[model samples]
Structures are given as C-alpha cells and as structure tokens.
Target: MNTSRRTFLKQSSFALAGVSLLSNRLFAAAAASNEITGIQLYSVRDDMKKDPSGTLKQLADMGYKYVEHANYVNGKFYGYAPVDFKKLLDDLGLKMYSGHTVMNKQDWDEAKNDFTDKWKQTVADAAIVGQQYVISPWLDESMRNNMSDFKRYMDVFNKCGELCKKSGMKFGYHNHNFEFSTKLDGVRLYDLILKNTDPDLVAQQLDMGNMYEAGGIAMDVVKQYPGRFELMHVKDEIKSKNPGEMGGGYESTVLGKGVIPVKEVIDYGRNKGGTTQFIIEQESYQDKTPLECAKEDLRIMKGWGY
Candidate 1:
C-alpha cells in the first residue's frame, strides 16, 4: 500500500476493531433518525472500478452502512447486474440507497412525447436494487440555453418523477455551479428549475460544494426553497490545485475540512430543509486516499450528530 493508505489503516485500526459493535446500533439509529447518511461511491471511484466487492468491504469496515453510486451502465452497477450488485452489497453489510445518472433531453423523444425505453429501464433496474432515488445529475447545455427548451425539459423532469414513482422511487436532480451561474431569460437556471418542477413529484439533491463556486450559499438556498430538497450531497469546497476545472475553480474535499459551514447547513437540512438523505462525497483527496477521506468525512458527520 501507499503511504497514505498505510497511514489511514493505522489510524483507523482501533476504530475498525470496534466497528462490529457500534455499526449496527449506528445504522439502526440513522434509519430511525429521519436523516439517513451515506457516502457517495464516487469518492472511491477508482477502487470501486478495480474491485467493487473489496471496496464495499472496506467501506463496511470503516463503519459506513449506506452508499450512493455514481456508476450505472448497461443495466449494471459497477460491472455487476442489478441483482448481483444488490447481493454483493447485502453480503458486505452495505446498502446503496441512491444513484446518479444523467438524463438529457434526448432521453425524451418530443415526437413520441415519451421517454426512451433506455431511460425507463434505468428506473426499473434502480427499483429492483431497492434505491429510493433515481437522480439525474446534469442538464444538457442545449436545454438550458433557451427558455422554451428549458421549460419543456422541466416538464420532462416531472414526467421522470412520475415514472420513478411507479416503482416506489422519486426522480431527483443534482446541481452543479452552472445552475446558479447560468441564466435563462435572466432568471438563474436553478431558480427556474425549482419554480417549474413539481415538488411532490421531483426532488432536488443539492450539492452544497458546487454552489459555492457559483456564489450561492447553502444557508440561503435552504431558506429560500424550504422543504424542496429531499437529498443533499454533503461536501466542502476548497481552492483547486488546478483552478478553472469545469469553471468552478474549486474542488470537493472532506466535509468540514473546507470553507463550507457543513454542519450548520446540514443541521438546517435535518431540522427544516426537508432533507432526508445526506450523502457524503469528496472528489479531491489531497494527500490521502479516497477511502481515507470517506472515513474522515463520516467521522466528522457523526461528531456533528448526523
């Protein structure tokens, strides 16, 4: 193992020894506590790609009971078919409750006035795996550039919600910097999305870190939308080594390790922001391995009473 990985294992060794005892109680409390916390698998994307089963075992060892996925292709998650993937997680004492899949305008055929069969399959597979949310994490530039097209696509978001609801799931959208920075008819794209979509049908998975680069504040957003957000991407933003990446000039780091007031915002989400799921994500590991970042993030969140 690399130095960072070795350091992480050494630091967590004592905690890991007691994980089997604390984990069940912690996970049970999280389930009954109205705020379900998890780690987004993207934080350990490379490890997962290399060994999904092993990666999950590591996460379970770190005391994480829930996970959110960033990979799903060809009706499979991390190279396993839905059934097999679910079994893998079950065997490792982990559960994937949410996943990110980008839905674009092309997924909906305007001529047929319906979603493509491929998108439908995505929701179906998600339901089979027991996911509660099927989240679309991006919007196409073409759809956002024009007011009419944008409004039309918002309707599609609602439709997707309806489709997901049939499987006992909700369709959700995750924001990036562009939603706040970009505008349609002089109205911020994020505002337009909230105003147009049905709150009951479609949910928003707010990414606390991405909004920072767009000059949006997490406290301000939760206060404005109140109860519209059902899930949140728990993240913290720090100066990027390579600024100008994706026009955000910032990258995600471990929660509470950056400038964002993560605990305060999450407190609001739990008490009043209508957020039920908080999934931790860290994309820039700095000097640590992704698993190390994930473990630290979880530790900090538990300290904050999540």
Candidate 2:
C-alpha cells in the first residue's frame, strides 16, 4: 500500500505537471500540493561512516521519513547488507526510496551488448532494499568527450532503465555543473541527455545547487524541461569563502538562508517540473555541522509545506 500510494501520487502529479507544461498554472497550484521530501545521506556521510545507526537515528529524530543513500558498495549500505540495512531503516520508521551509485561506460560490455554482472546485481540489490530509483550520480570523463560515444552511451542509459524496470524500479541520472557548460556538436550535454533518454524509463534527478557552478539557472532549466524531472536535489547556494568544485566561488547553505529562490523553485518543480522527490543536500556548511544543516534544511522544507 505504501509503494502503491507513493507511485500513484508521483505519477498523478507528474501527469498534472506534464499537462501544464506550456502554462504557468502549475506554479500557481504548486504550494498546495504535498510532496515527498527527504535528505540525501551523503550530507551526513562522515557521521554515517563513523556510526551508521546513530547518524540515521539523528536524522529520524529530526523528523525525516524518507532518505536517499550515497553509500552502497559490495552489496552493503554503509556496512550492513542490503536486507539488514533495510531493516535498520524500517526500525527507525524511515524509508530509502533512492540511491546514488556511479554507473560508468565500463560497466557495459560492448562485445556482449549487456551491462556487467556487477551493475545488474547492483540494480537487483537496490530493489531488495525497496529503492524505487537506482540513480547514477556521475558520468565518467570518457563518456563525455565525444558526440557519437555520448549518444551511444545514452542508449546504454535506456538499456539500464530497462534492466531496472525488471525490478519494478527506474534508472535515473544526477547532474552536476558540467552538463550545462559542456557542449558537443553545438548542443549542451544536458539538453542532449534530456532529448535522447526515454522519460518513462529514465528519470532525471536535477541537482539545483550543482548547476550554479556552471552558471546554469535552475528555474530556467525546469522551465525548459517541464515534466521531465522526477527527483531533485534541493539546495541553496552561497558565495563560499573556501570554494572547491566551483573555482572558489560558491557552495550550499541552508535552504532559503542563501541566494537561491529555494521556495520558488520547489513550488515550481512541484507544479510543473515533474518533480516529486525533493531531497535536501548540503555539501558545504559555513559555520554549522552537516547534521545541523540537515536538520535545518528539513525544518525549512516543512515550513514550505513539503
């Protein structure tokens, strides 16, 4: 019943967004729609790595019902096996709906025309743990350089989507700044990706903060791809005194406390961006701890009626 209702709500809302793609009515109705909001566990990676139970408990105490994972390797999440980890989450009254696992070109075998066993197993395990989405958070450098290869790899994305579909899950991709700035054959990589992938199979998990590094505007992207996004990384950017990835320029701060029109974006996404999964992620906290940031981000989301 939980999965059914969750899927129905997402699919129905997505259809609404899709219908209002050319209209602004979606934004008008956005705030009234309740959305699934959660935190990306990577925001507390260090805490989790040190004490998975305690870290999860803290998040649960902060009133997070859903979570997305960024740490799953060798059939384990943080350190527990898939089944055990799922139990841990269930015990805390928390659910994990998605995960970030990097799927590179090497994971596919051109000779056999199939994904490597490892990647297949990855998808299978994700289903075992009740993940609705198995998202590859990063694309390797090799997949980005050539137009022909990139397009070919997009086909692989479709195939991965098929593989995931077997487990009643969808394949997803997360973006960083490069997708906006980088171009091939006069086409922005992000645009190409959206154009090429099948929406039913592949979902885009747009990270609003990551695009700031490339000067990409989240509002503009959402408008351009109405009803295309299913998952979103909600973050606000602040000029960072110690920038790392964006050339010492900016990093994430608490929602609404920073420069991004966080509420507006979420509202728009809810109504028109086909976004039902809003996962909070704060990579850089100025004066606050990551856990503190996580708690604050949730508080802000709740205030926004998510």
Candidate 3:
C-alpha cells in the first residue's frame, strides 16, 4: 500500500545488524502468556508525526495497553530517546511490544561476515524501549528479484532473530503483498522464507489485510502454516474506490466492516496459527478520521472479546 512508514524506512539511513545466536527457549518462555491487543502507530501516522506525546496520551486514554511502532530513527523512537520513550509510554500505561525497521544490504557487511554497528544499535535501542520483537517490514525489490540473494537474506533474517534472542526479544518479518504472489524456482517466496528460518528465532507477523491485494487469503495462509505466526496485523479489507499502490482492488477499513472475514480468520489464528499479539492497523479509514477509526477499532476488538 506504500504507507508513510514504508516510505520512511526506504529513505531513512537507519540500518539493522545481528550478533551471535543464543538459546531462545528462555526468552520464549517469558513471552506474554495472555493475548495482547495493540495498535500499529502507523494507523495514526499524521497524529504521531505532529505530536507524539499527545497522540500517545490519546491512545492510552482509549484503553490501549500496547503499541507497535513504525518509526525509529537515529537511535530515537518518534523523537524521544529509547529510555525516555519507554518512560513516556510507561507513564501512560502503554507498552511498545514490537517495532518496524527495514533491514537491508547496507546493514550487513559481507566482508566482516556480520552486521554493521548501526544495526546492532537498532536492536539495542529496541531492547531499551521494551520491545519484544523488532520486525523488518519490507523486503527490498533487489533482494526479491534474485533467487540466490533472496535465500541469502532469509538467512540474515534468522541471524537477526538470534541477535535479538540475546536481548530477550525475537526478530520478526512483517509481510506486504509481494510474498504471496512472488515466486522463485516455482516456489512461493513466502514458503521459502518459512522454510529457511528457524521458528524459535524468527517470527512471522502476518498482515492480514496487506496480502488481500495480492489475492492472498488469511484463512488459507494460517491453515497452510499452522503454528507459525506468533503475531498478526489485525486488519480488514474492502473494494477500494481509488485503487493505486494497493492493487487487487482493495484497501484497509475498520474491523469487521469490510469484505475480509476478520473475526473468523483471527479466531482461526488464535486457535491454530499460534498468534498471541493482535495489532490493529487500518490504512484507509473510509470517511472517518484516523483517530476516530482507531477508537472504533479498539472498541470493536474489545467487543469481540480480544
């Protein structure tokens, strides 16, 4: 859909890196046992950009306890240093459980056989801000076109997972429309990624709505890869009036107010897909303001007993 956060990741100089692997058993055991409902801050991108503090307060007041960030630049999260941001969220009874940062070739040094310091710093800051997962939201176009390089980057994704394990966090990948439609050697790109990465280290945060544009069905994916998804971008889709970047004639809308079988698919995810975190994300709000949509989304999720 070419979201604002997606554009930021493309332009920002912030990079990602990895370190040695560690046992994830302990970390996994420490994961939140109860279901968590959070909002991807990108749902209110303009509000966050204008007044991060005020936006956060509004979210907290709406009864949101968790958030998933989409901006981290220059060792800061939305202009606040990691520790400061954590404190700000804590004060408002909110916690950032996950964040999106694009990890590309620049983050990895082939010669050194390791990630650059800049990426290591990204993970470090994620830990400081109490993030349970550091998710790379986009797969660069270059990496996807070549089979060899694509598989190589999948290995890097696992390496990042190992790196995050040392800090009691898990490394994750969030999908766009490409993974479902793109193929290599006749194999779907999404299948290759799931095969290459270790489940204990790397996690999948399925964006239920993003893939609709690519002819992906959330129910089919969950059934095909049961127990693989640990996180989910809870969303609903509808036929778009102004279709552009988001192809397949679809756009995001309020929960359960669209064509997607939102509740049915998410219920399946909970019972079979191993999804514990349901993070709400609505990119196109129809005629409603983003904040209005956010509030309604939270209310709907609660009503559905999330």
Listing every candidate in turn, what is its Cα RMSD in Å to the true structure after a full C-alpha superposition?
14.2, 9.1, 15.2
- Among the numbered candidates, top lDDT falls to 2
Which ten residues in a row are the worst by lDDT in model 2?
Answer: 26-35
lDDT of each residue in 1-306, candidate 3, tens digit only: 656977777655343211112223433344436579999999999999999999999999999999999999888999999999999999999989999999977898999989999999999999999999999998888888878999898888889998999999999999999998999889888888889889999999999898888888888999999989999999998888777236777889899888889898888877657788999999888889999999999999999878
Per-model TM values vs. the true structure: 0.88, 0.89, 0.88
Candidate with more favorable, higher TM-score: 1 or 2: 2
**For residues 25-120, what per-residue lDDT tens digits would candidate 1 score against the true structure?**
775556447668899999999999999899999999989999999999888999999999999988988888899999977899889999999999
Across residues 180-291, which tens digit of lDDT does each residue of candidate 2 receive? 8899889898999999999999999989889987878899999999988889999999887765555648888899987788888878888767788999999888888999
Clash pairs for candidate 3: 17-119
Off by over 4 Å in 2: 1-34
The global Cα lDDT (0 to 1) of model 2 is: 0.89
Which 10-residue window of candidate 3 scores lowest in summed lDDT? 15-24
Per-residue lDDT of 49 in model 3 = 99
lDDT of each: 0.89, 0.89, 0.89
- State how far residue 273 of model 3 sits from its true place (Å): 1.6
Error of 2 at 37 (Å): 0.6
